[model samples]
Target: MIGRRILLAAGVLFGAAAFAQAQIDNGLPGPQPLDAGSMILNRTLFEGIMDRNSKVRSASAKPMPAGGYLSYRASSKVRQKVTREYLARAEKAYGKPIAEGLRKTLGAIDFVATWRRLATRDGLRTGDLGDSVTAYWAVNWLVANGKENSAPGQMQALRRQLGPLMASNPGVRRMSEAARQEVAESLMLDTVVLAIGADTAVQKNDPAVLAKLRTTTNDRFKQAFGIDLTTVTLTNRGLAKR
Candidate 1:
């Protein structure tokens, strides 16, 4: 369903900007890359994009569409402003030191383009952008770091979490099967982001950020899909290979 949201959202962003190829940073020479650290330390990733999108669309003479992720909406003025505000929020979300490090990393990155890729054609063909990419990064770090054993999961997690909601909301039936599946899967992606974000926060010695992340994440989840993740059991899952 996330893809449908993205596709529908794309109506406003078509012919907007270059879609970036997201990759795990290899410390190699390139335009910019998002490795594990960037993903972890910069937890307000989506918020920043949304802020830019809202700012840009509001600035546009003609009405700009707003259904999905389109942070790369062109607006020279708002780019840096969003970045600055985002960093301030980041400092609040992750502390000053880590935020400073993120700033150094951001220096070389064109985040607008990168954010657009997450919800556009540049997103990998195999899966929707938010879930696939977020899960990959979140799980990659967890599994690679041997935290799979400790990785958190939502009880009736993403997929399971949506079951009741879908049955009640007949409007969801209008969506294609692929879209529904993607939407369900996308919920798990949010869990992964929260899990990884919490883990990162703990490691950074600011364990408090986890609660805030969870609250905000649930709010966003509800706003996006009209389901409340707060009621779900958030524990661990048997994450075996599919």
Candidate 2:
């Protein structure tokens, strides 16, 4: 089983990607509902986070330090503690679901690998059309990743290469905009599906977690993408519905 904290934390960061406003508000179907057990897992993990009498809000509340990679290192200790608790709760609540989600996400398409393969086919790199397309895909991927699974070192390299290209070329900027939007939509849909799945797993033992997940997911979507998912109705008046 995946560490509950890692799973929860990852979900909180990347999973929220499902409902992150930027990803969702493009008039997309927000995060899809998870299976029954997954919802329970999401619910329980969140409850445990909130139950602790500490500085952090619930695991689902958006850890202040773990909100993005930029801030992750700043509060490593606190985040680690939360991560442990989150994993613990997840283990007790949902076993396979937690591990499965991690594997799927961690294994999801490798942007860099695909780019390299495609680039070689086109014979392009560094200050060439191929480079431009690569940068385009990369930026879009980073945005979709939305700070989760975002390795600072990898992002730095990508930025070092593409930053100047976009800054120097108006044509490239214009060319990439549409592609970026399309990628954003794809990511949003993916995120929605994951959130729906996780929420479904943990909604039983932890109502508070369920509620926080709904609010955090909704708010992040609104803030990041400007997409609104009205009210999602679960078996009961679960958070996602509203």
Per-model root-mean-square deviation over C-alphas? 17.4, 19.8
lDDT of 2 by residue, 198-223 (tens): 33425334555444444544554444
Residue 239's lDDT in candidate 1: 19
Residue-pair clashes, model 1: 4
lDDT of each prediction vs. the true structure? 0.32, 0.31
Cα RMSD (Å) between model 1 and the true structure?
17.4
| Model 2 worst lDDT run, 10 consecutive residues | 63-72
Model 1's TM-score against the true structure = 0.30
**TM-scores of all predicted structures:** 0.30, 0.24
List candidate 1 segments past 4 Å from native: 1-73, 122-216, 219-226, 230-242
Evaluate residue 9 in candidate 2 and report its C-alpha lDDT on the 0 to 100 scale: 41
